[model samples]
Target chain A: MIRSKIPLRTLAVLASPALLLPVAAADDYRDYRAEAMAMVKRDFQAKGIAGLDRLEQDGVQAVCNRTGNHPPADVVRRLEQDQMASVRFPADGKLMGDWKEGEKLAQNGRGFTWTDKPGLPVGGNCYNCHQISPKEGSYGTVGPSLYLFGKKRGYGEDIQKYVYSKIYNAKAYNLCSEMPRFGYIGALQEQQIRHLVALLLDPESPVNQ
Target chain B: MRARFILAATAGIALAMPVLAQTGASADFQKFRDVMEEDNPAELFEARGEAYWKTPSGPKHASLEQCDLGLGPGVVAGAYVQMPRYFADVDKVMDAESRVVHCMVTLQGLTYEAVTRQPFSNQSGTPAHVNVVTYVAGQSRNMPIAVPQRHPKEREMYQIGKEIFNFRAGPYDFACATCHGTDGKRIRMQDLPNLTRPEGAIKAVQGWPGYRMTGGLMLTSQWRMNDCFRQQRFPEPKYLSDTVTAILTYQAVNAKGQIYRGPGIKR
Candidate 1:
């Protein structure tokens, strides 16, 4: 029934033009990507804080996007290493801060949008994607639940540093994780990341309780 | 023994409180939506739209009876399902909303700025263009989507739309794919549609030009796309631009064979 509805002459016309295109232009997704990027850049007008640079892809983003978030193992390893190297741990070497402050950061989901003010402390936006505190009635499940994070994985110095690093630059561990690079993007400060680490690792925190 | 049983039952309800709170609203919303579907308020907007289509107004004092919606001048049925097509008169492809705006400008002598000044309805009132789109979409009820790929420009738009879907940038490094590329995943309780496939794409295209019960305002797909970019923390795209038309074309073509249940109600 569906076949009967299609105009055969129109299909034939559609086939011819596509056939006449050059082989490189016909099959390359890159050409279309370039054209689409150009269109996006053209059609969107910069307003408030969201500048044209927001549309620009960094090196890591470019690789993940081109490969559909599955870059070659060698490239992933190299990029991951670079991302890991980008993390600047606090000079004082304290990886843990007040969980009370961390809880506030986790609850906040604002910053860096066109509507937000610049130079203000940004939010961790943790609850938007991770089940952080069991007491929180509404939490997202984009990432695995971090309930009992410290209880499950012993509250040690190694684990504390790992949590700090992960929040600072998630791409260091997974190349294309949906979790944002909170600290690396300048969206979170050094103290802010420490508070989040404390939230995950502090035994007294609700996540561990 | 009776006291013990009552205490245990109280404990059970306390333990279940969070789970209940989470699912309770959505379940209640589902019931409300079912009731609304039987007699949607979108009909009021549709009736208003028909009045707009027939009434002679605007600067030229002309009605839109002679407006070509791709079927022909004054032909409205099934045109919504087959639009975002190439119009030879303009020599560019246009979506249903864009085409309606064009007619309002050319036939009714309404300035583009004036017509699109308030493209979306708000707490104040519903826009005429949104009502017109709802009315046009209603004419295509239960029809199979057949957005044409006959034009070279139309096919190019589909390709461009595919690229835009996968393009990642901005502060969070999110594309539409981050939330919507995968199946059986969600943010909070809201289920995300994997628009790369047909089943998922159909979900994206379904029930648009709908009346949202939350604000009691009518909305179109154009407003939805605009909100997505806003949520992604990107700058807004110009109204009736090629960027938005490309994305609409991509979704519509992907959902080609799905039945359109026109002018829906949303919670």
Candidate 2:
């Protein structure tokens, strides 16, 4: 429907060429994250795809949020272990998919907003945080560039499994990662993650070029 | 193979800013803003709102001449800059929109829902409240923003608003902080001010009740808050909700000393 998230989507659309005079909302500089959570839950509604359940932080979100995305090492280790346990890998041994499809998913940032029609495909929005392919001129710096994923890391089945699992649940690897848990949250499927893995690891993929 | 694809995907995310002289789009937007400021269609709303305020037409067949903007009855001048204040009669803090709806209900004999219905403007028609907002906001143009916090409720609202501003939620995991809390960030050519800090918040807040060039709609602070949340993928806030007012108070108070300079012209 793309109707529910009118506010957020409008801002997102406008920001592309929008000029709201750029204002920052202000400080979590102090750790009042718990207080913020209560107010966040109270103020915002959970309509359609954006249910109140999303507001309820899982263990990963809880640890990351409570500490302003900086949970202690021991806590991160335990939580990361728990998150890893939640990743449901494909039943079949196959873990690779089309890099072309993966590139489309990585490029798409639509989905998860309350307005998005349910069951429609969601995108990884990878470029919003990383520079995956050199061909693209604009990419975000929120995450490190993966311009040569397979080239730098070496192409191996071990690498493929790691990439697959990582996309499934980034928190499993980094407790407070700014990246979303695409597979863990069901935003992406096994096939989709396979494609994304290929997007990075496939030697023929532009990313490796 | 990778070389040609990035060109098509270059527009994927709207990040970064270039100055007016630096880029074609920025230069165009700057020109549009300047032209609109010289002759803003938003001023028409102000004129209509003034008429709506003075002319008696509600079920009560009375005017909003008795409406108090925390500056006594019917005092529109310089009243907007101090909005999102605690109203004793309603027992809550209200921004300009809330105050207008309150008057429409109390004096005009309109139902709360009727007044709030069609709260935002589209290509077709402007909302009744928007006209009143434009009128009220125009009256305070060039005045310094001095949103009050003397009342306990008002103070509470400000604190709540600050928290709301920081509270992150939704699919993309965006809080207002995701895009706005940081400095030197942009979603395309538009500059993002750090609302957490007084300096940044003032510049951003100062522009609302503005005339949007893209749609030629006059937007208010209420609309601003509403739109921001929509983009956050949160549920639509009720018209004049405490949460809405609280967020306004937070932005307003941060912008206390800046000259209230709207119904502004915006890209």
Candidate 3:
């Protein structure tokens, strides 16, 4: 009876002071990010959904990590073009999907954790870093609030394309942007990016409201 | 798919509900933390650990009486804060856990493989190495934090640690900075330590080898690192590996003057 009443995951969230740690490393102001990656490659092994290849930074990550996320203008211009060239748009040329599905994907933060089942579907985790739908009360502040993404940015074809490409490869627009190259790595599929595009660019979407 | 959907819905509402709940929940959590600290259960582990340190129970039938924790032999006090230090015997930098394993092998004649197993804890109480490490950390409470960086290898460890702290990988592309790195950021109600600054770094690293109240367990920095990597979605680091000490060196040097206050309780 107790087992029936209780959830299986009652233990996962228990006493998690690991993240609540208040310590930060001082800016030794050293270029150790590359060496750190080498150490990680040697120190860590692959398990489940997470693998060794994840340690291998793409061109964008290599440049960003090396420069402390602050590259020179010339470097940024060249790299941004390189990143933007990587986005593969849908063959159909349509750039919108169901907003309701988009809302679900944006709200969901489950995916790609080592504990997660391999090859299972992943969530967008958008709310972990951005505000998407206005109704979703809790949103992270790592990025600018996107509650009026469509309204403020102007919901146009170019806007739709911009939103689509940005979500696909954020570094494509701004070199060394903290946002992951979501579309660049296929973390989200073509349709999923389209759905996310709708969530951000559709006037009817709660993000616009 | 259905389970995922249901879980997503549950998570959505859970994240959504807090704005309405406001500050009341936070106050209750704070009160709960205060009560938990009023009497730390980690002391039990410390007691058992103290016994393990003194009592002879190895192939050599020896106690760790002569084991040097960078504070000479058998001097437990203030040794933990200066750990992850370079030891001439092994010719490498080691954190508290690795140093214990080294002592266990040479002083007590235990096998490295057994003492350095994958998971630090078991279904049965705490592992021998973990208990000893936990006890040692308890001895250094209130001592000023001072992990050594004199040796070239020690300095190398610190540099490597800086990178690992910011190393972002895996499917989600999350790194330590994904949650931390900002001045004031939190996941839900939990505070995310900005591990790049002194004030934040001291509070984050000092209070480990802590007791987790919900699970009724004593945790070493090794276990804490293991849990963090798991949460960060990376495979586990081998126990007492160079990677582990490197990370510790980075944290310790940052919190150089902050008084240690751990073997503390966690909510």
Among all candidates shown, the one with the greatest TM-score: 1
Which ten residues in a row are the worst by lDDT in model 1 chain B?
A: B22-31
lDDT of 2 by residue, A108-177 (tens): 8777666778885787888876788888755665567899999999889999989999988787898666
Tens digits of per-residue lDDT for model 2, B1-267: 453344323422222344322244434554456555757888888999999989998899999889999999989999999997888888888888889989999998999888777888888888887898899999998898888889977877777777667665455455676667776554434556778777878876776788887878888777888777776766666567777877778877987788877688776
TM-score result, candidate 1: 0.86
CA lDDT of B106 in candidate 2?
93
Stretches off by above 4 angstroms in model 2 are A1-46, A138-154, A157-159, B1-32, B187-192, B213-215, B265-267
User: How much is the lDDT of residue B267 in candidate 1?
Assistant: 79
Q: What is the DockQ of each candidate?
A: 0.35, 0.21, 0.25
Comparing only chain B with the true structure, the TM-scores of all models are 0.88, 0.87, 0.86
Per-candidate interface C-alpha RMSD? 5.9, 3.9, 5.3
Go through the candidates in order and give the clash count of each: 0, 21, 10
In what order do the candidates fall by TM-score, top score first? 1, 3, 2
CA displacement after TM-score superposition, residue B197 of candidate 3 (Å): 1.1
DockQ-wise, the better of 1 and 2 is 1
Q: Report the C-alpha lDDT of model 3 over B1-267, residue by residue, as the tens digit.
A: 555455455544544676634433444554555456546787788888899999998899999989999879898888899988999878988888888888899999988887776346645668887778889988998788888778887888888888877766554456776676876665544556677777777756765888876667777788787777877767767667788888778878888888887587787
CAPRI grade, predicted model 1 = acceptable
Model 1 ranges with Cα > 4 A deviation: A1-30, B1-28
Cα deviation at A139, candidate 2, in Å, is: 4.0
> What's the C-alpha lDDT at position B185 in model 3?
61
